[model samples]
Target chain A: EDQVTQSPEALRLQEGESSSLNCSYTVSGLRGLFWYRQDPGKGPEFLFTLYSAGEEKEKERLKATLTKKESFLHITAPKPEDSATYLCAVQAPKDSNYQLIWGAGTKLIIKP
Target chain B: SAVISQKPSRDICQRGTSLTIQCQVDSQVTMMFWYRQQPGQSLTLIATANQGSEATYESGFVIDKFPISRPNLTFSTLTVSNMSPEDSSIYLCSVKVQLSTDTQYFGPGTRLTVL
Candidate 1:
């Protein structure tokens, strides 16, 4: 079975603090890993996509890195405005309809 | 990247009633999907809306309860039939532009509250 698990269900950090969220997965054949940021009452916004191990992508203060079995989303000097639920999803070879297996997501709070 | 829009950002409806959510894209997309999200939970795929064909539903979902329509390449609709309190959730629409890639862009979801 292909599944995705995100750790640290919720995190509280002071402004300017940095942390990394983990997204571990078990899939037969990994096609791609995606990261998204969703705010309250809004849809998720695309952040990054990591296709292979040792691959990384960055946007503003966020960086996403991928491995064989997991992916990490690192936040640098996060501000209060950066607080949101971070979602992780993966595409596997078995999903012929282009469906993605999703994780529960990590709720991040940046207290000023 | 594609721009997507969903109608009726939030609504309050009585149980046994139904609500139809519309999703429109700025450009023609190859794939469109509907998802349901409970508060503080992960997204669950409801179905895939295919243009000019019947929508493909997921394992736990059915067409009768959640009918979908894809009239063209850039527009689709998802109707929640005989909605119940358990159906109170955020229904989202997403689109994938390219088949070779796996990035999906989402629209501002419709927040449904059933009484």
Candidate 2:
């Protein structure tokens, strides 16, 4: 079965701290990996999509990179406003159906 | 990016009752999906709402439990039948405008609590 796993279920970072969140996935045929930021009591907001190994995307102070086995979300000098849950999801090729395999998500708290 | 909206932002319900959540998108989208999320847990795809067709449910979900209706390209409804304590969750609706980008825009979500 295809699955997506995110590491460090919870993290606490002081303002300006830089860190990286990990999302490891095992799929029959990888199509795309997505990153999202979800604030409390709200739906997820789109972040980045990595299609292949070595692909990278950036937004503001955040960057996402993908490899064959895993994807990483790197936060640079995060602010208190950056505190939120980061979600990772993977999509398999057409053969695996159109469902997206989602990770448990990483809850990051940045305190000032 | 598409803007999605869901009715009944949050609700408290009694067990055995049912609730129908509505999802609307600002623009006509090609794909619409429904998901359930327990507190502090990951999202589980319930089904894909296809316009003018029956929804495609996931492995653990059934059409009888999560009946979905897509009357048009920009509107859909998901009815949770025979609710229980286990059914208490945050339901979200998402839209995909373009398949090539693989980007999904989500609505505010409906938080349901069954007692």
Candidate 3:
């Protein structure tokens, strides 16, 4: 079965602190890995999509990198406004439609 | 990037009542999906709203309970039927515009509270 697991269910970081959240997965024929940011009372916002190992994408202070069996979302000098739940989803090989296996998400708190 | 919107941002309903959530997209998307997020839980996909066809439901979700409608490419609806307290959740609508292979843009979810 295809599954995604995100570690460190919750993290508390001081302002300007940098850390990396992990998303490990086990799938048969990985198609793509996605990262999303969800604020309270709001749906998830798209962050990055990593298709292959050694691939990376960055947006502002958020950086996403992909490996064969895992992905990492690295936050650089995160601000309080950057605090949100980071979600990880994996798309495995499917014959008909695109289905995503998601992680529970990492709740990040940036204390000023 | 695509813009998606959902109606009735938040609502409180009595048990046994039903609620329907609407999702509209600025542009036509190939795939639209409905998801549910229980309090403090992750998003669980309920169904895939396929245009001009029957919506495909995921396991543990029934068409009789979470019926979906995709009359066109730019709009869809999801109805939560025979609601119970356990059915209270944030219902989200998402769209994939084929910008690439992945990446689903989501709308501000509808917060449902059942009493």
Give the fraction of reference interface contacts each candidate recovers.
0.94, 0.79, 0.91
What does the TM-score come to for chain B in model 1?
A: 0.98
Worst 10 contiguous positions by lDDT, candidate 1 chain A: A91-100
Q: Which runs in model 1 stand beyond 4 Å of their true positions?
A: A95-98
lDDT of 1 by residue, B1-115 (tens): 9999999899999999989999999999978999999988989999988898899898989999999999999999999999999999999999999877789999999999999
DockQ category of candidate 1: high
Isolated chain A TM-score, each model: 0.96, 0.96, 0.96
Specify the highest-DockQ model's number: 1
DockQ of each: 0.94, 0.87, 0.91
Q: Please say which candidate is ahead in DockQ: 2 or 3.
A: 3
For model 3, the superposed segments whose C-alpha errors exceed 4 Å read none
lDDT of 2 by residue, B1-115 (tens): 9888899999999998999999999988878999999999989989888787789887899988999999999999999999999999999999889867778889999999999
Q: Under CAPRI classification, how is model 2 graded? A: high
Model 1: clashing residue pairs?
A: none
Give one digit per residue, the lDDT tens place, for model 3 in B74-110: 9999999999999989999998889466789999999
